[model samples]
Target: MGSTLVQRRLSSALAIMTFAVLLTGCGTWWHGDHQSVTIFTTPPDAAVVVDERVHLLAPGTVSLNRKGNHHAVATKDGYESAVMTLSRTWSWWLLGDVFGCLIVFSPFCIMHDIDEGGYYTFDDTIYITLDRKSAAWAPVK
Candidate 1:
């Protein structure tokens, strides 16, 4: 009976440790709100403005929240400033989060996105073209 009790306790301890590991993502660390994204321009060196507030240079990386729609605008000298929106769509991996339910405090699997070191790259490379607004000759006033 003593031997049997020892085995049972060992099993229970193992299970609890496993549960804790899962909750911690097995060493995966991440911030709940911070996600990474990369922005690039065709010509590069364009001033990239994000959310109309944060400014960055093209071919650069930026961190953004995963909660809402994010916007980026690229402007280069003599080029028509271009705008693009980066919205957080549903991540398919969230479907696999069902197993995460077993671990308390680990809803990460079911979360909206996968934060692999916040290295999400923009899907499309922004392209900007130079714009020269044509002026029409007018009569002297």
Candidate 2:
């Protein structure tokens, strides 16, 4: 009958539309030759370690695309050294936190009062001076 043919055609059209939508919603697949790594430090002047090797750059973020297990270590004099593990998802989180903190603190840093002319009298004052060098890291040798 003509009605049967119409019903089959409609069902076919619906199935094709559903398939198209599923394919489009899947998004693009990640196919790349490298992995991403992100590093962050508290003081922003600490040394960075990559895979147990010391990178001679200042305490900041460095990205690597090499695959495999990557280790990171941050160190500065007079402060404790920090070790971090890296993965695809975790690296993204670290980058987000680092950038977020920087954005949030930028205004505060720019508007800080650096004048030391004001003096305050306190009943008890304690001051401690520490002599420490810059940060450094090296592979186990």
Candidate 3:
């Protein structure tokens, strides 16, 4: 009877651990709210501005928040600046959150991901081309 009691306790503990793991939002637990995005531009050393704040030079990688839409502007001397918007969209990770949390009957898990912005994601890479200004209007040396 003593060994049987210990075995039952072990099984209960294992079950509880499994339940807790499932209750953790799959999206938040896996992807979180920050994503690394790579940028490339026609002019190799063009200045890249993200959201008019963070600055980088392509080709490079920047970590961006996944909560909302973001924009990038790439510019080089004598070239027209190029702008691109990185929009956040629902991802497969959100589906993982829905199914995994549903298995544990925990709506809070899904809601937690929604509130944390883990259900959305941005593209992994961005590429832009800057057109050179007209010869007639080119900057004087």
The model with the greatest TM-score is 3
Ranking by lDDT: 3, 1, 2
**TM-score of each candidate?**
0.56, 0.37, 0.77
Against the unseen true structure, what C-alpha lDDT does each candidate score? 0.60, 0.42, 0.84
* TM-score winner, 2 or 3: 3
Q: Model 3, 1-141: lDDT tens per residue? A: 999999999999788768666646777778878899999999789999999898988999999887788999999999999989888889787776666665567788778888887888887988889999887876879
Segments in model 2 whose C-alpha atoms lie over 4 Å from true places: 1-31, 54-59, 89-141
RMSD of each: 6.1, 21.2, 4.6
Cα error of candidate 1 at position 42, Å? 0.9
Per-residue lDDT tens digits for candidate 1, residues 31-124, read 3455567787866788988998889887888777755668888888766778777866544333334444454546664443355422122343
Q: How well does candidate 3 score on lDDT at residue 82?
A: 91
Model 1 is weakest, by summed lDDT over 10 consecutive residues, at: 117-126
lDDT of 3 at 41: 94
